[model samples]
Target: MENCSCKECVSACLNDPGRLVPDDILKLSQFLGISIDDLKENYLVRVPVTSNGHTAYALAPAKKKGQRYIANPGTVAPDYYAEEKGRCIFIDDRDMCSVHEAKPFECGAYMGCRNTFLGKPYRAKTVEEYFYKRWKSK
Candidate 1:
């Protein structure tokens, strides 16, 4: 999506947050001026991710409820937006990304406002593969 803020795109934020790559985590940590540990404790949650039958825990912005993210992994927050969509913790009440400057790669890659990808739509899968390798090291 480019130069568009359609309802579908806005619904993306209302549905679920995106997965945070390692770099996303670091960026958010610095942007918030907090240690990674504190960020994890307060803003991020570990969720299960699976690819090719292998599963691992990945970090993402927490879900908001009662003024804070449901940061517990064992809690009821949706792990994947495609499967069980929910609200992003960073989305403002006006339906905009509050942390738009430092949003996750997964958020901006696949879904677009006009449902029009800049070049290749499959970049989403490509990015997922890239991150899968990164996470494999953990």
Candidate 2:
């Protein structure tokens, strides 16, 4: 969230993890020095997102159960579930993000984070719809 320090945004990682846009997948892959497929298989969870009464698939930085991200969160083709949702795997001991340089788009762009990377504030659903389109295109 850049220079922001709001509690809700920071504490969000404690339960709900941030959503990822399509470009974030590639950015995170490059940032971690891993292939796109590796990032998808290991770090991301494919989850269902809904907007306008329709459902689509999208990605999120996986929530962790132990020291690792939960496996098979990407259960099926489009409507997958994380089952036991947990904290963000990238959160450090100090409760700060370790991947700020390539953090998920919603983490940096959403109003909950107090840093509007999209130039202005937007409803969370608006952001979700944007991501939904991007994922559907892929």
Candidate 3:
């Protein structure tokens, strides 16, 4: 397969923010110079995993609702970043990720033209366990 530029993958992320594991959250917190708790409280949304009786965290999208997308006002994305609909809060005016270096595991492993790596099962399970532990402790 030819190496595809990140355009497609970046577009997909902009459309739908990916789910984040605990380690990803930690990395984002460190990158944004914020506490993990603050990040969770302000920028993450809890999604119920009913089958497992647990919850997963996904990054929040921009606030404006319309046919066009809106970049989060709180982030570094320029005000003119609005385009398309349902963009992730972290995508900037240039369609670049503001937190590219600390992107979630799924985003990091995604390859639009190749078989994607969904992370090791053992690692996912371990992270899930850790996430729940921390969630409950808080």
> lDDT score, residue 48, model 2?
76
- Tens-digit lDDT string for candidate 3 (13-67): 6565544555677788899999977886666555322125765333333433343
What is candidate 2's lDDT per residue for 20-108, written digit by digit as tens? 87878888889989898888777677777777887777877777766755544444322333446578867778888878877777776
* Candidate 1 local Cα displacement, residue 103, angstroms: 2.2
Candidate 1 regions exceeding 4 Å error are 1-4, 65-82, 114-119, 122-130
Model 1, 1-138: lDDT tens digits are 334457776676676566777788888778778887888777777666666767666777776655645555334345443465567777777778877777666676545554533346545555556567767666
RMSD of candidate 2 to the truth, in angstroms, is 3.5
Q: Which 10-residue span in candidate 2 carries the lowest summed lDDT?
A: 73-82
- The best candidate in terms of lDDT: 2
In candidate 1, the residue pairs with backbone N, CA or C atoms under 3 Å apart (3 or more residues apart, or in different chains) clash, namely 1-112, 1-113, 15-86
lDDT of 1: 0.65
Candidate 3's C-alpha runs over 4 A off are 1-5, 50-85, 119-138
Q: What TM-score fits each model?
A: 0.72, 0.75, 0.58
Better of 1 and 2 by lDDT: 2
Give the Å shift of residue 10 in candidate 1: 2.5
**Alpha carbon deviation, residue 12, candidate 3 (Å):** 1.4
By lDDT, highest first, what's the ranking?
2, 1, 3
